[model samples]
Target: MPASRPNLRTIAEHLGLSVTTVSRALKDGPEVKPGTVAKVKAAAEQIGYQPDARGVMLRTGKTMQVCSILYSPEVGDYGDPGFLAQVESLAQGLEADRYSLVVLAQTSNKDPLEPVIRVHTQRMADAVVFSRTTSQDSRAKYCLQHDFPFVSFGRTELLTPHAFVDHDDEQAAYDAVKRLIADGHRKIGMIDPPENLTFFGYRKQGARRAMTEAGLDPESLIWMRSDVSVRAARDATTALFRTQRDATAIVCASQMTMIGALEALMELNMDTIRDGIGVVGFGGMPFRMLSKQKLAYYYQPQRHVGEVLARHLHDLMVGVPAQELQTLLPYRRIDDLAAFREGEDF
Candidate 1:
């Protein structure tokens, strides 16, 4: 009868049953009689009574909710396409499994793990998924120490076991670089992410390994490191060109950065995949039509990552041990340039 959202107490009062009986019946507890369960279910449906997530967590030590903490300072500005896609996918997947998601954005100066700690302490979330991990990340460590159910979207350099869903960045970068080498391009350059981020470092390592396998001098390869920002990527691209005018190809770590690099290349009047410069970027962008036709790049299923993560969290919540510590999602290359020339619909 109240205007506010219905809770267990309200439902119990309407159904002429104790709150405990109502709660157990709603959860289908064996102690609750089948008739009582039916009555409670029907009453809940009639009044739209939803269990308080925090109260359920307090009573059962499980929150049917997951928090995704975004640590990138430029999360709003740079707008990681993969991250956004994953969030959307994860939300949908969780909803299908009767769970909810909360997004927490952490800025540069803030401790990324603080939100997770607060949520856990307040019994607001059952689990957390962290993105953009670093080597010896304090957030991961904190989660481990607190025995919180958490997973990462990226891997750390640590030896300890932690749940994660990530793409094989090292192998992907290696494969990308090898593709360029096979295309008769030598003196390749890379616009890598900062070393502080383990994923970026792994990508760099893969690129170097690929160069070595191709019998190219690693030292001769131009490499620049910067934050995962458009300006940073643009600056790195400009710097690479300034230092090595003969460099014929550029590898980028992200689509956003690649856009900036492409703009820089256009400004310098360098021919892409024609006169001299060839561009290859990692991941797909929301505004993919802007990319030049036939650009070589690896594309990760951003939405699939989120879907897998949500499934994993659901398994954990349902008393299943999530055994897979790190699940690597699959990726593919868009090799056809002309097919994308007229801007194919996504």
Candidate 2:
């Protein structure tokens, strides 16, 4: 025969306390005194008692958990360090609010939305957080259609109202390009991510806007789009330089792309930031390892983005009527052009 499992009633009877008190103590309810909680925990530990998560969830209408869905099209690797840091910070924030976090990675082979569907259908999580949103994002639309509690790390161009936390990529890109112009770089090049991604599109738009403001022809700027891989970036960089007018400065949308562009520059024996070819990249990179002279980039507050998203989701879960759509964060330039021109180390 299978061994019988311990329940709250059995634990209460063994401790000579009411089942309600036992349940509250186990739930870490504020009403339960610390002394009583200690005693109840001791009794539970003695009997090797474990709370039935499903039963508690059914009673409370909450799983006390949240999930983050990672939509990575590539295979082999699971996630990036920046992404992991965001998840870690978000998990810590949720834990402080008396909640749990579950990470779900979506591969190309599996249905990208399957994990979200399972969690919502099974009532396994109180809310969900979606990252890497694209224009006309079906995932965001689906969540809204079903009335699922969810927030996005990136904003979509779709009209559907949803809560999201994202960096001001447009402004960031504009600032980056403007700084290059201020540094006496006339021929500016831009390496952007795919156009389908709303986030990347905004960044590209910002670059163009800044160029137009500087009295430079928008069409004169060299623009290339590629994946986040080093190989893709290298190919794009090769194509970018093949243009009739070579760029004196290059603005990259991401650190990964910046690295590839640098490799291509080195291969071509072009002294970065020295051959009158300056480079400015958005997002943080390992500046410590790279030559300081060649490194001038923006720093993104990825962890802060996670924290704000988590707080907003918490409020939504607690019945707060947050804005149907909100932009809660701003992006700032990390390095100043004046400072860079002075050869100042930062």
For candidate 2, write residues 176-283 as lDDT tens digits. Answer: 888888888878777876677788888878888988999988777777877765567777787777663556778777666677778887887777656777777765
Report clash pairs, candidate 1. 294-337
Task: Go through the candidates in order and give the clash count of each.
Answer: 1, 0
Clashing pairs in 2: none
Leading candidate by lDDT: 1
lDDT of each: 0.78, 0.74
**Model 1 per-residue lDDT tens digits across residues 98-168:** 67888887777877778778877887777889877899988888887887888888888676777888878
- The list of candidate 1 runs beyond 4 A from truth reads 1-4, 7-22, 30-47, 61-63, 122-124, 284-287, 337-346
For candidate 1, report its TM-score. Answer: 0.85
- The most accurate candidate by TM-score is 1
Candidate 2 lDDT (Cα, 0 to 1): 0.74
Worst 10 residues of 2 by lDDT: 73-82
Off by over 4 Å in 2: 1-16, 25-51, 73-79, 108-115, 122-124, 284-287, 324-327, 336-346
How do the predictions measure up, each by TM-score?
Answer: 0.85, 0.81
